[model samples]
Target: MRFEVLILGSSSATPIYGRHPTAQLININEQLYLLDCGEGTQVQLIKYGIRSNRIKHIFISHLHGDHYLGLIGLISSMHLVGRKEELHIYGPPALQEIIDLHFLHSQTVLRYPLLFHPTQDQTGESILENEHILVSSFPLDHRIACTGFRFDEKKRMPTIDRTKTEAIGIPTAYLPLIKRGNDYTASDGTVYRWQELTLPPPIPRSYAYCSDTVMTERYLPFIQGVDLLYHEATFLHDMLNRAVETFHTTARQAGQIATKVQARKLLIGHYSARYKDLKPLLEESKSIFPNTDLALEGNWYNV
Candidate 1:
């Protein structure tokens, strides 16, 4: 199984010449999970060669225009393209109303089913789960009701030792129970321990996404020790005061959070438009957290 993230847009509220707003595509076990559908996200997806039909789940952090202005357009395009698969959207309370109003005014009935799952609380909890992975959302300190998401893969089952089984003349019927950690007792009273016949399961991988948040340590527990973390760094250290005033985070602040959480790697973005060059921001973040990298548009990070 592969887990990867593609940076679709990195610019902040103000649009830059070639950059769009905040959006990302997270692919886990072949399922596409979209985070923050910023303006021009569909176009970006097309540019990156990502098929829109693969996106089954979309997560919005807040109601900011820069974070979700492209949602209606994306859905409309999906409908026009004759998408018949059900789509699930997770966001704050008002998101359903906003999309409903848009569809109502346009009199466009979607060709596929749209399911809205609203985030109503602050504490971190699992929001979506399947056999292979689980997704959890936690509250973040922002100007509006915002949340961050954590994606964790499920622990894999232990691999069987085929050589041991063959040597012992074990029937293929008992392989299933043996792989599940169950000891198989032969007809002659020969006992085979599961631990002796199987190797340990692989460690699960995790990724966390935090967007448009202020400096807050409360999220450390939820995102701790993730393989990769994507956090917003909208300003440089010089604009710490402005970051506080606007409820955004400076590059250094984002690095500090990544350090506190002990993340393997950190990617920071949602840059303020005033910055024509992001070298300073990247340098500032790297000064605190050496593994930090700028969230460049069209770049892919494997988790």
Candidate 2:
């Protein structure tokens, strides 16, 4: 199973010449999960050759226009394309009202079932779970009610050693038990231990998405030890005062958070439009956390 994050847009509230608003797509196994749907996100998805239909769940961090303005268009497009699969949307309470108003005014009936899960910014809890993965949301410091998400892949079952099983003449019907780390007892009282026929499962992988947050360490516990962390770095060190005033994070601040959390790799984005070049931001972040990278649009990072 592979987990990857594709950067769709990286700019902050204002749009730039080549950059769009904030958006990211997390591909876990074969399912697509969208982080934030910024303006022109659908176009970016199409440009990157990502089939929007594959995205079953969408997570919105806040109610900012730059973070969620593209949602209505994306949902409308899905209906236009005749999507019949049920879609699950997770976001703050305001999101439900926004979508309801849009659909009510347009009188557009959705062709597929839509499930809305409203998130309260005060609580940190597991919001979604499946057999293969789990998703949790934690509060973040921002101007508005906001949260960050963590995606954890469930531990896999131990692999059966075919050679050992064949040599032992174990029945194939008992292979499931062996993979589950269970021991089998034969009719003659011979016991077959699972350890002798199976190998340990690989370590599970995890990724965290923190968007539009200020310099706050409260999220460290939730994001600690993530395989890959995508955090917003809207400004450079020189603009730390402005970052604080606007309740946004500087590049160095983001790096510090990543370091404190002991993340394996850090990707920084949601850049301020004033920056014509992002090399300074990238260098600033890498200075504190050596494993930091600039979140460029259309770039894919494997977790």
Candidate 3:
């Protein structure tokens, strides 16, 4: 039930001002998912006390060096550490080739199986799913083929009222039906409504990650209503032209996007190295969206 994100790094392009590049670890229901293994991510993982072996899935937004330059090293470390569990990686189509070439030249055969999933640059699509969560990848406006990820918790079954059920002599066989919101019929032909036997299920939670992308309306629908949103704000509003030219978003624009999506919380990061102090960027974002938080390195944001 622990759903949180640990930001490993927050700088953009290069490490500076005590910040590393872009890397994040999202933990949901005890499973780990790595987002964008930028340079020094392995070291950051160690510094943060996160077990790298727990990372079964890695999602790369693009081929940008600051976004995923540390991937090969991480994968290689997993091999050296004797990892046997299969690892799944999702990213642009060319990512597999890049990883393959790295391993080929290094003459490294992974100790575990490696699977690559290519994200479609066209639209939002469900790329991974399990009983507890569903992960979808959506295209983002960027200079290269970039995409964002949405993590949504699955709908849970209604909580059964054990006291009511027992008092009504409801059989164990009917529990599943009750949880599914179906009325249960007794042997005497009496009907017990599901509402009378159970409480409503908790609302599902969701998180969205958008990094290395430009401010565009196309991503609005995909990220709407997320409990927590991590959007890149690589520059301040004063550098708007530079941000636009580089296909990156400014702090002010990032906050506006969060407001438009009606997100509960917005975490802005991927700061430009030129910014030794992020106060100005944070202030600009908060002016538009008051619920914004700076995505600082080693910080954990719960959803």
Candidate 4:
């Protein structure tokens, strides 16, 4: 299964240093999920060659303008493009009202169905699940009600050894059961072991997205052991006090979180406008968590 995150924009409250706002496109098994629609997200989608129509689910972390200012525009564009599929939005309860108010004032009616799923504050709950993937939300420490998302690929069935099965004279009709780890009994009363006919499935991979939040341990368990973790680093350690006051995180703090959670790799972004050069932030983060990488726009990080 193919799983990767495409960074669309990576900036904090304001866009600076050539960085846009916060947005990401997560592609899991060819299905696209939009995470946080910050300003100019539509333009970034176009620039990155990601088809907007492919995105059926949008996740908003908070009500902050920098985190979700581009949502209405993107939805409007989808309607203009004649998209007929249902659009599922997962966010705070107020998000539905905000979208409805915008459409009411603009006299714009979407041609497709709009479904909203609100995340429960202060809770880590499963939001959606299918055969291929599962999505869950956990509360984050921020100025307002905010949440982080975890996307996990489901465990796959083992592959059947076609040559071994054929040589053993197993019927083709029993291949599906063998792949599911089931033993087959022929009419002659011969039992075929599943272990001898199939190979073990690969380990499932997961990715977590933590938007603007203050340093806290509350969300650690939800993101533990993820293959890739994207955490907001709005400032450097020098502005620790400012980060606390604004309910944001520093690069060093982000590294600490990634380390504590035992994440395979950390991708840090949501840079403050004050940072014209992000080398210092990266260096500071790497000093603590050597596996950290700066979340650069247009880059794809495989999970």
Model 4, range 1-303, lDDT digits (tens) per residue?
A: 899999999999888877999999999889999999999999999999988989999999999999899999999999999999999999999999999999999999899999999987688999989888999999999999999999999999998988888888898998998888789887789888998899888899999999989998788999999989999998999999999999999999989999999999999999998988889989989999999999999999999
| lDDT (tens digit, per residue) of candidate 2 on 85-186 | 999999998899999999999999999998999987787899999988999999988999999999999999989999988887889999998898799777
TM-score of 1: 0.96
TM-score comparison, 1 vs 4, better candidate: 4
TM-score for each model: 0.96, 0.97, 0.96, 0.97
Local lDDT at 70 for model 1: 90
**What is the model-wide C-alpha lDDT for candidate 1?**
0.92
Per lDDT, what order, best first? 3, 4, 2, 1
List the lowest-lDDT window of 10 residues for candidate 3.
Answer: 177-186
Error of 3 at 234 (Å): 1.0
Can you write out model 3's per-residue Cα lDDT over 6-119, one digit (the tens) per residue?
999999998888899999999998899999999999999999998899999999999989989999999999999999999999999899999999988989989899999988
Candidate 1 backbone overlaps, count: 0
> Least lDDT summed over 10 consecutive residues: which range in candidate 2?
212-221
**CA-lDDT, candidates in order:** 0.92, 0.92, 0.93, 0.93
Off by over 4 Å in 3: 171-173
